[model samples]
Target: MSVDDGAVAIIGWDPSLVRETVARGLRPVLVRDVPAHLRGTSIPLPEETEEIVVEDITDVGDVWAGLTRHFGERLHQELRGIVTFDEFAVSTVAALTSLMNLPGSRLERAVLMRDKHLQKQAVLAAGVPAAASRLVVPGSERIRTPFPGPCVVKPVAGGGTAHTEMVRTEAEYEALLNKLALSATSPFVVEDLVDVAQEWIVDGVMQDGVVVFSSVGRYAAPCLSYTTDAEPLHIYRVDGTGEDERCAEARAFAGKALQALGYTDGVFHLELLLDRSSDTFFFGEVAARVGGCLIQEAVLLKHDFSLAGGAVDVALGRPVQSTSETTDRCVATTSLHLPRGTVVRLPNSGRFAAADDIHEVRVAVLLGVNDHPEVRATTNWQGLALVSAASLAELDARMAAVRGEFIEQSLVAPTFGTGVQQRAFLADYEDAWRRLL
Candidate 1:
C-alpha cells in the first residue's frame, strides 16, 4: 500500500529526514521535535487525516517509552509501524524487541553494528581485515597498539564525524588522549590509520538474515576532510551495478559483514576503505540505519529504493520490493558548509534559480548576525544544495563552479568588537537564541 494509506512512526535525530519522510507520503509521527519553520512547511492535516506525533527524543529512555506506547497500543488501534534513522534507535529497538515479543536478534545485532568496538570485534573474528582498534573507556589510557600511527579517534557512539580527531604523530596522539577526559569513562575508539586507496559506501536491506538488495558508493572527496568541514562541498563516487571487480569485492565484503554481525532484518549502511596497496578491503564503520549524508537520497535516486519505507515494512512484517533494478540518471549533493567566523549573508537565492542542474537549495543555518565559531569548533550546517546533473563530469564542474562563485564571494571578515570579549559575546548570543527558540 502507498504511504498515504498507511502511517508510520519515525524515531531519529535528523529532523530533515523526518521532514522528507512525511513529504514522501508516509505520515511521519516524528519522535523528535520539529523546528517551527519545518512545521510550517509540513503538509496540512486533512479532515480525515492520520495523526502524526512529534516528541523530544534526546535520550534512550524517552525513545523506549515512546516506542512501546506507540507500537504496543497505537499500532493496534491505528495502522502504524516504527521507522528510525538514528543510532539511538538501535538501543531503543533492542529494548523493545524483548518487550514487544518480536525477533530480538535484529535489535541485538544492531547494537553490535552501531557500537564501533563491538562491530570491529565481530568482523575481525570473522577474519575480515580491519584497522587495529581500542575502546578507550574511562581511565583506560594505557591502551597499546602494534601499528599506532596517524591513528583515528572518534566518539564511540557518534556519527557525521562530530568529535572525531585525527592524530598524525606521537605528540598529537598523546595530547588527544590526555584531553579525552578518560576519567569520564565515556567510550571512544582509537584505530590505526590505513593509507586508503578509495573510500566506498555499501547499503541494502536484509530479509530473514539474508541479503536482498544492495549497492556501493564511491566518495569524490576524502573522508577525513568530509567529516570536519563547513562550506558547500561534494563527496560522491558512483552508484551503479556494473561488471567491475573492485565493486564486486566491496559488495561481497559488505554482505559478509552484515551476515557476520547477524543482522537478520533491516537496513544496513557500511563504509569500507579499499586498500589498493594491499588489494584488501578494510571495514571503516557500519550503521544499522541508513547511511548519513546524501547516501540515503542517493540510494533512492540512484536505485529507486526507499530503505526508510522498506524498513518500516520489515518492522511491520510486510512485504518489501526489490531495489536492484533502480538507477538515477544523475544526482549530486553539496553541503554548503560555510567557514566559521565568516560573517556572510545569503544573496537573492533566486539568482541561482535559473541554474539548469540546481534543483533545490536549502538553508539549514538561518540568516542572522551571530559570531561564527573558531576553526575546528563545530557549528550546525549552514545549508545544503541538491543538484541534478545530466552527467558525472557536469555534476563535478557545476558543483565546483557553484562553490567558487558563491562561497568565495560570500566570504566576509566577521565583525568583532574586541578579541577577548568574543567568547563572552558568543555565549550570551547562544543563550539568547536558545531561550528565544
Candidate 2:
C-alpha cells in the first residue's frame, strides 16, 4: 500500500530528532516554521529530506504553497501524505490531505478531535465511559455555573496541560480562574471530577481499522501530585509478560474508546483516569498524535519500534507493524521539581549517561550568569531522567541513582531590591508595554 514515487510533506518538523521516526519509501519533505530558538543553531535533518521554510505553515494556504512549490515539478506523482507533530496543526494537515487527494485523516474527524466539548459529547453519546463536562466562556452569564467540589476546568482548545486546574473548593476555583487569566470571550471546559485514584496513558499505532501497536504506562503518582509543591511528575511503562492482565484489559478498553471517538488511523495518545471504587475507567481526553515526553523513547526501548515513525508509515499507506507482542522491560520518565529562581548548579549527568540502565538525562532550565527564568506551572520542570529495568523496584532504584548524584541547590534571591533583578525587569517591562498598547 505504500506510495512508491511521491514524497510526504511533514508539517512542523521536529528538529530534535535528526531522522524520521519511520523509514519511508517515499521521499521525506520537511515543512517547518517553529521552535524559534534553533533559528541560528544547527539541528540535525535527514540527508534526503526536502526542506522548505515558510512562515505560518499551519495556515492551509501556506501548506499548499509550500508543498506545491517543492513537488510542482513532478505533478504526475502527487503527495503521499501530510503529517504534523504540532497538535494545533492537526486539522490543517487533514484538510490539506483531503484537498490534495492524499492518503490521510478526514477533516471533520480531525476537527472534532481538536474540540474538547464536542469530542466529549460524541463519546458520551456513543455510550463510552466518559466524565460529565460543560462548556464555559470566560465572562459568560453562566460563569458561575455550579460545579460541585472536585471539578476541573481547562481550555476548550489547549494542550501541554497548560492552565489545567482542579477545583475542590470555592477559593481554589477563584484562584484557578485568576491564574488562567482568561479573556472575556475565551472558551473553557468545566467538568465533573471522576474521583480519580490514579491516572495512566495508553499510546498505540492504528493501521486502517485495526490497532497494530498498543501499550499501557501509568504515572508513579497521580498527576494531581502537582497540586502541591512536594510532588514531581513520573511516568512508567507497565511491565507486561505473556498474558499480562492489566495490559490486556487496558488495550481492549482503549481500542473500544478509540472506535467510539471515530479514530480510524494513525497514532493515538489517550489519558485515562482510574477510579476503581465506582468502576469508572473513563478516559479524560484523547489526542490523535504521539504522546509527549519520553514516551517515544520508551516505545523504542520496550517495543523496538518508533511510534512516531509508524504513524508516518500509516499516513503514507505503508505497512506499520509491531516487532514484539509483550515486553518485560519498563521505562521511567521523571520530571524533576526545584526552587524557581536562578538555578545554581544542575545535576552532573555524565554518571547517569554512563550507566547502562539509564537511557537519557535532560536539564530543562537554562542557566544564566546572574538571573533566574520565570517559573510557570508544573510544565516548567527542572530536569528529567529516563531509566529502564525489569521491575518497579529496580526502576525506582535506577532513577534514584540519577537523582542521588544531584547536589541540593536552591534558587537564591538578592538581599536588597528585587532578588532576581533581570527577570523582574523583563516581567515589569512586558506588563507596561501591554498596557501602553
Candidate 3:
C-alpha cells in the first residue's frame, strides 16, 4: 500500500536533478555529509515519511558499507522502493539486485555498459551490430595484432575519455602500449574504429522491463571533433515521426538490448553509430543514467518530462507523461576550451555572459589552479559552455561567439624558491614587480 507520500533515497546527489525532485515535493532522505558518513560516522537520518540516501558511487570501500548499512536499516521496513542515482552505488545496486532479482534495476547492465569490452561482448551476443574489440595487456610483445589498424584504446571502466588514444599506425600503437602504466592486473580495451555516417543517442525510460518512452537525439558534430578540437557539440531531437525508419530501427535495437540486459524502471542512455559502410547501426556505448552534462537540464527547462523526476513518480505509482514535441529542437553545449597557460589577465567579465542564446558558462580551471591534465586533449577542455537554439546553425553561431571572447594572457611561471628568494625573483620581473612589489 502506498503511504501518505513515498520517500526517495538518491544514491548520489549533485546531478541537480535530485535537487529538482526535492523541489517538486518529494521527500529525499539524503545521507547528510556522505564524506563524513563514509569516514565511519553514523549519518543523521531525517525523520520523514520516506528515506532517500544519496552517496558518491565509487569503488571505495567505506562508502559501500555506510550506504549498505543505511539501506538495510531505513529502507528494509518502510520504504516502497530505493532509487539509485550515482554510478558507484554498488551497495545500493547489490541490495536492489538481491531484492528484485532484476538485472537492469540492480544495474548489472551498468557494469556491462561501464566496461567497454564487456559491453561489446554483450551486444555482439545479442546480434546487435558492434565494432570488434579486444582486451590488451601491457608488454606482451607477442601482442601481434596488425599495428595501426584504425583502432581506439581506452580504460576498461569509468567515465571521461582520459588516456583515450587513437592508433592509426603501427608505431603509434606500440608507443601507446608502452606509455600506458599497466600492471599484471591492468588491462585496456581496443576497438576497431567504426566508419560512422552519423551518431545519435537513444534516450528512454523503462518500466517493469518495458520501454515506455523512447526518443532519438542526433549529433550535429562529430565526437572526436568536438572533444579533441574543443568545438561546440550539438544534439537535437530528430525531426521525424515515431515510425521513421531510423527511429524505429534504433528503438527496436535499443529495446532488445534493454531486454537482454534485464533493465526495469529506470532511465537508460545508449549511443549508436550509424555505420556508413553497410548502413547498419553499430553500438557505441551506454549509461544506466541520463547522459552526463546538460541533456537532462534541457529536458527539464524545455520539456516538462524529467526522467529523474519520473523515476520518483514511478516509485510512487504516480502519473507520468511523455515530454512534449516542442522540446524537440536543436540544442548544443560546448566545453569551454581553456588551453594550458597562465591566466595573467582575464578579459572583460561582461563579454563572457553576453550571448542571448548561451545558457551557462563555468570556468573550472581558475587563475591559481593547476591546469588539468585531462583537459590537454582538444576534447577535454577545462570548462563547459551550454547553449540551445531553434536550429543547428543558430546553436553553432552562439557557441562560436562565446568561445571567441576569452583571451589567454601570459605570466611568469611560478618557481619554487625560499620565500625571500621568490620575492626577490618576483621583484626582477616587470609584471610581477608591478603587481606584487
Best by TM-score: 2
Give the per-residue lDDT of model 1 (tens digit) for 317-393: 65667745554456766766555454545544566668867655565554455454332322245656566676787
| Top lDDT model | 2
How accurate locally is residue 86 in candidate 1, as Cα lDDT from 0 to 100?
70
Off by over 4 Å in 2: 1-5, 15-18, 34-43, 73-78, 142-144, 178-185, 241-243, 344-351, 369-378, 406-437
lDDT (C-alpha, whole model) for all candidates: 0.64, 0.70, 0.60
- Ten consecutive residues with minimal summed lDDT in candidate 3? 41-50
lDDT of 1 at 364: 55
Q: Candidate 3 deviates by what RMSD?
A: 6.1
Ranking by lDDT: 2, 1, 3
lDDT of 3 by residue, 1-437 (tens): 22245345555553354454455565565543456345432233334323323344453344345546766665444344445555445335545544644333554655664677888888788887888888777677555345538888876764455567677887888887877745334578889988778887787678777777766677765465444454545556653423378878888888877665556666778888888879888888776777755566555544546777666555545555665554545555565554443444444444555766666665545455335463334335555666777766777777776666543422423443357765764566667568775
Clashes of 3: 15
**For model 2, how does the per-residue alpha-carbon lDDT over 1-437 read when each residue is reduced to its tens digit?**
34356677777756422255325556677777655424533345656567777667768988777776777867436566778767888888889878877766778888766777877898888887888878776555656555566787878877766666667887887666655555433578888878777787888888777898887888776665554446567787774634267667777778877788777877888888888687557867888777666777777777777777777777777788667544577677877655444454466666668878888876665553333223234455667778888777888877775665643533433323464776685576578679999
Task: Find the 10 residues in a row with the least total lDDT in model 1.
Answer: 42-51
